[model samples]
Target: MTSTALTDDMALRIGLAARALPDTSPARLLAVLADCIGLPPNAEKLDTLSIKQLRSGASGELADCDHSVLKTALAYLNGTASTESMPPPVPQSPLINASGSDPEGTIRVAIASNNGDLLDGHFGSCERFLVYQVSADQFRLIDCREIDDRQAEDDKNSYRAGLIADCQLLYVVSIGGPAAAKVVKRDIHPIKIPDGGAAPALIGELQQIIGAKTPPWLAKIMGQPAESRVRFKARALEE
Candidate 1:
């Protein structure tokens, strides 16, 4: 692998490891991490900041982990970071209510989840998928599929992708490069939502867009009706 790739991988590893430790503060984690990697110069008082705060600080403070490491590390910390250390999926919201119907012309989106609620799981690690049908003004919970744990890695990813094959988009906290490729090959767009967002929060944002304008990409695929666009513009001008 290239030097940059190596650093990125290391940063992810460091972030996950740091979050797993108990009673560990971000500042202390950085201090220990620095010492292990010969701790860069010009780094002072970093051990006092939270992982979230540290990412916003200077590159000089990060020493070697600056270039590609800081952002990825912080993403892991913010989205997947926890002292629970690979704990089972805990729902951050209420149980989803799916009607088992997919509305035509709506984008079919899938989210990796441990619970029946949030997009707080990795594509490879999450055992379940929450499927949503998203139109411009509304989104509906349509289906839920759970993977069989007995499958091997090769069997698992592709199989999981197949379960939600009809979906146009997939969301997850993280996904391995290979698994992401597999998802894409099935014609599904994979979206990485940082900070492990709640499913309802994300759905609400999409609904707001439907009420406003259709994004270029979605417009291209779903193709808004000409009359509706004209009507929407007329209303906009009137307002």
Candidate 2:
């Protein structure tokens, strides 16, 4: 089948499916398609392709692929994946720490997310911000901020930054330079996780850092003692 036979929409779907699969290239995915359901994969072929067939055909390309990832890829290929079904439900009510108290050692963080508590959204395009109150030992989902149509107007970067201005750290799959600048201007550190994963898992990693040698920047955010901050900073500089 000629490349031209695949429409732009079909090509886009293939690209997205390829991205879903670990270490898969579009060319390799196309090869798998050819193996699974003959040449020139079209909407009909993709829509009709079975998961068993896909898994069988991907033996070489996705030998170590996670089952959920493979399923997501196939869903994308069949055009059955909907962004609406991806995200996890938010808390029924806001659970902010309203007693005017800190949890000994805690800082607020915002995670850019589109799917079910996954840190999988770019700063500019994520559907919502999952705000959490976290300490070295525990965390709680305090708020869920949605990016509505109203916020789409005028300096979107500034607006998005302002939405989570109270957060000390922001986690995202990606962020543009200008957006990062805006976040930093608001005294929020923007952290980019190129391959996003579960927010809780990422937060666990942060907790490890906090429990261990907390970085100077993090220490400052947690309002640690000046001596502790200086010690960490000196060690970091020495390293």
Candidate 3:
């Protein structure tokens, strides 16, 4: 097949793979793309697909496709295409479990990205924020906040932080110390995931963390609800 045809066909196959998924939101699809093609986990720069059309598109498994071309395409779109030959893509995760048990506790997160899916946007110029409600059992996308066109550049970062003020954590590829401090001042933790991965992976991993043996940081941010705590106490008394 011609290169163009191959790419289009491959893209179609990938889309089909995506559609096979139970949930095909752009954020979810991009996370799957990152798993399948070695795309870094946040909304950076992928021209082949945009986050705006994520839910409509599909992604599950691009099994038995050309790895070389896939690598080149991902690198090119991500601006990492080099003269040297691309390496083989790392193995991708097949799916993200979107369903959750009961959100033992909820941790709202903001991921910075040029697109809604990749964690590629820097603190200075991200196009939007994809907000998610995360729990050990399941997670769901709750909102997408775009940068205001009328907001001055100087105040935009702070404004963006405000947009996700209810969120507990902010994940970005990079952020300045001052901006991070500003986020912390608002009681939101800013985590710099330089090697951004898919949001589902990140969120799922955190869900596991909270569900299993939680770290101190996670525990602090995820205090049990009063009812749950009360129930636990009642159960302890019964025992």
Candidate 4:
């Protein structure tokens, strides 16, 4: 990756990791990380670093920092932090009061989640999938599919894909190539959220895209009429 891209990606990870360290700002974490791993931090470097290295690097200004928080910070940086260490879950809102009735033009979305109502889970490691039926005007939580430990031990990625087989879209903080292939084979589009956040906000953004001008790929997935697809294509070409 380009230096700018690496720095930007590292910046997002540092921000999340910093949250784990009490009173530690992203800038402070970045400086400490740089001291430990060298300048221009990248994900590959951070993934290889250990808690011991971070503690050893925490000197001068951070010499007196808590070790527990440092370990938590490293876990967050590596995307291995447990749900308990993550930010509190957001409550599910606008959950469907009625079942088996979906609005026209709606698509089912599976959000990889470790904490409540947040798109903070990786495809392989997230605790559950929060399923939502989303349309241009509204969205409602339809189900939450918990991962089965037994299945995880054997062919986990395929098992996970089976859990959300009905969903047209899959949102995850990160997904490995093999896992992504499985999802795609099931006709589910996988969207990676580098900096995960509240599920509602992300779905709202998707709603906007659907309402305004659906992309060609999305249009196809939504099964828009041929004329509608042509119109969308024309509009996109005009831009």
- Choose the strongest candidate by TM-score: 2
TM-score against native, each model? 0.52, 0.64, 0.51, 0.63
Note the Cα lDDT for every prediction shown: 0.59, 0.78, 0.57, 0.75
Runs in model 1 lying further than 4 Å from the true structure: 1-101, 223-239
Better of 1 and 3 by TM-score: 1
- Candidate 3 lDDT tens digits, 69-187: 23423453344433222222222222234574324466788887554365645565566777777777777777667766357466755777788887888997767667788788888
Q: Write the per-residue lDDT of candidate 4 for residues 1-239, one digit (tens) a residue.
A: 53533455566677767654434578887778778887677767778887777766747444443454455567778767652434434325433336644545888999987677888667766678999888898888878887774765668789899999988999987677888999999999999876778998999999998875898888888878888889989998999
Top-down TM-score ranking: 2, 4, 1, 3
Per-residue alpha-carbon lDDT of candidate 2 for residues 107-188, written as tens digits (9 for 90 to 100): 8889987678888666766678999888888877888888863655778788899999988999987676778999999999
Residue 219 displacement in candidate 4 (angstroms): 1.1
TM-score of 4: 0.63
Ranking by lDDT: 2, 4, 1, 3
Per-residue alpha-carbon lDDT of candidate 1 for residues 137-225, written as tens digits (9 for 90 to 100): 66667677776756645466787788888778888776667778999999888887755677878877766766456655554445567
Worst 10 residues of 1 by lDDT: 40-49
